[model samples]
Target: MSTQPPRLPPPAPEDAAARNMRLLVLLRWLAVGGQLATILIVHYGLDIRLPIAPMIVVLAALVMLNVMTWLGHPHWPVTNFQLFGTLACDVVALSVQLYLSGGASNPFVSLYLLQVVMGAVLLHAWSSWALVGLTSLALGLVAWLSPPLALPPWFATTLSPVYVIGLWCNFVLAAVLLVLFVTRIAANLRSRDAHLAAMRQRAAEEDHIVRMGLLASGAAHELGTPLSSISVLLGDWKGEAAIRADPRLAAEVDEMQAEVMRCKTIVSGILFAAGEVTGEAPERTTLRRFLGGIVAAWPGQVTFEDRLGEDRGIVADRALAQALTNLFDNAAEAGASAILLTAKLEETMLVLTVADDGSGFPAAVLAALGRPYNTSKDRRGAGLGLFLATNVLRTLGGTVQARNRPEGGAETILRLPLVSLALEGSR
Candidate 1:
């Protein structure tokens, strides 16, 4: 049994894109800071003569772009193309800044590699490769057209100790940024993959439920004829003179008739749940009355607690009712003599909890609670009750969770939106 905690549903593609965009915006702000620091240190601290005016204008434009992106990101739909465009803008800004300083001679020219790496991770394949081409072209153009930097005599040559130190500093900055942003991007991709896997698992479970429902419906239809025949035979026997004269025989006939009627009821429920029978309208009742009815029908020692201060009208869902009944049955089968059921309204949700003094579920069963045939019971077809119940709740956009209580017993919780069962016009 795996003890992994439950995971929240995956975010939509747009949500993921929005998050990635925010990451880009943050990276841009960091770039702005790093560029400002390097420009100041070189122009003032190192006594290098740089074209400060035009470079400041480019830095200002980059700042404005970051501001606009941060403000407008949530208003528009985010997409791969949008991500590609954002990265392209960053590349353009970087190239312009480099052209102003020393073009390709600036050790910071290596920073173009950082943009390419980001594109590879965040953009579509074609866009990624296009960014590669764009960066390569920008580098060549800057090298060809820009004026040479007015460096000190000691730093004039590329192999000078001062030039070597500048290159080393640029390498360290690029390496740190890469480690920070790339890891975050990788984490986002992993999250998206996990969500996709969860969706696939849910699709598979739903398919399995459909197949089982069809089989159960067909079985019910076949059993209808034999059950009807037996009911008619018992009716005749009850009316016969010999059986009527013997009170004991008549009593036994009555018991048999009751048993047959119970079996017929079970078959009808199966058909109804499968949508094979839909002529009758759904029953409508109050929440309190509906739960009370279930408890009254169960032939066991059960306690009901209604923490819902006010009752709301609801369309009685027989499937939901049966699902709760299955929980009770499981409790009894697990050697529980007494069960406690509680109902309450939490915000817009309806919550029901069942706690029992039964031997709690085995660790393996708890680990694979909703998966079909994942049961501790040794008998054939013993696990379908919980499986069917779990699926029923899932169909209603609810979930069922079970765990062993530390005090010695098991607890199962069911939660669903109240709107799923609320009566029309009864808010």
Candidate 2:
């Protein structure tokens, strides 16, 4: 099996409070602009006698506060308390404007509901209710204390249709703006949550891979000395006169030697995976030559077909070879007598297909092809062959897929982008 150092997932991103605060600041600017326009329309167009000087002072104070807020640590996370205080400031500003113009009789007096709705959507339940109470109290006090705004004679009448129409327009405008901002904000929150969840999953996967690597490395270290001793004894016996006299004894000794070498290779692979030792470095070779070399290493019968026409050079990585070897080993375990490997260029990608005339993977295994420990085999080994292959290929900007062949077998497809491989080599 290819021994790759465990892959660690990237770090989780910082919280979204800073971003949300920036967004709120922009929204507040919109609110300021809207209020300024409304004030101008009432003072000039309607020709009303109102305290423009005091009203302008209130607007200027709000604008200054917003400016300070913008400059103050834009990177600082906005907490619920901070948001609550900001909304409270807005409510106070609106109440002051209403008190000067027309108390609770102003059509824009309904704008208090905007702060209430925002509080409900953005703050904790208790905090939102607190804001509602505060705004309600402010509204009542304004109506009881401030003098009424001077308006056209037609609107002064209690039964005036113009007053009713103005209220209707305020209600519609408030409803539309509230729904629009709330929906957009809600979507932003959902997107942030989803991204965080995905990062958490990757972290879990990385942890599992790290634990597995530790176990493999420890086992390899413990077994290496004994396997080496066995090989030495086998070599000595093979060179003896008594063993040479008997063909059966010589054959058995040779088989033992081969098995010992296999064990050594396995231990080395594990050590390499632990990043404790470096194996053979990557070799520069054509795609056809690389595939041929790997297939040649297998003792079983394998049919190889290369249809790429011209030779395409690649850096041969030991891990890639080990990954493919693991796949072949799985195919052999599934009772495949002969395997077929075909390679071709699909656009700018190298597509290699490995097919075996064995019982195809069960439905369950096919569904979770590259997940670790998902296998039907009863063996000492974990079902990590496909998992390792998948990860290794993924690191090279490639993908591995498995399927059951209708012709009574299993097939694996590996697609690797040539450009990605070249880029990886350059790096």
TM-scores for all candidates: the values are 0.62, 0.58
Clashes of 2: 0
RMSD of 2: 13.8
lDDT digits (tens) for residues 1-427 of candidate 2: 9999999999766555555556667878888899888889878888877798898898898889788878984556678788888889988998899899887578787888878787767776567668867876786677667776667896673424465455545554554465457656866888999999977875776677789889988989989989988988999999999999999999999988887887787688777767786456645777788889989877778889888888777776666778888888889989998799898998888888889989888898888876788788877665888888887787678999999899888999988887654525543
TM-score of 1: 0.62
**Whole-model lDDT per candidate:** 0.85, 0.79
Stretches of model 1 off by over 4 angstroms after superposition: 1-162, 245-248
The runs of at least 3 residues in candidate 2 whose Cα sits more than 4 Å from the true structure, single-residue gaps closed, are 1-181, 278-282, 378-380, 419-427
Instruction: Give a tens-digit lDDT track for model 1, residues 195-308.
Output: 999999989988988898899899989999999999999999999999999999999999999889978877877888898764667788999999998887776778999999
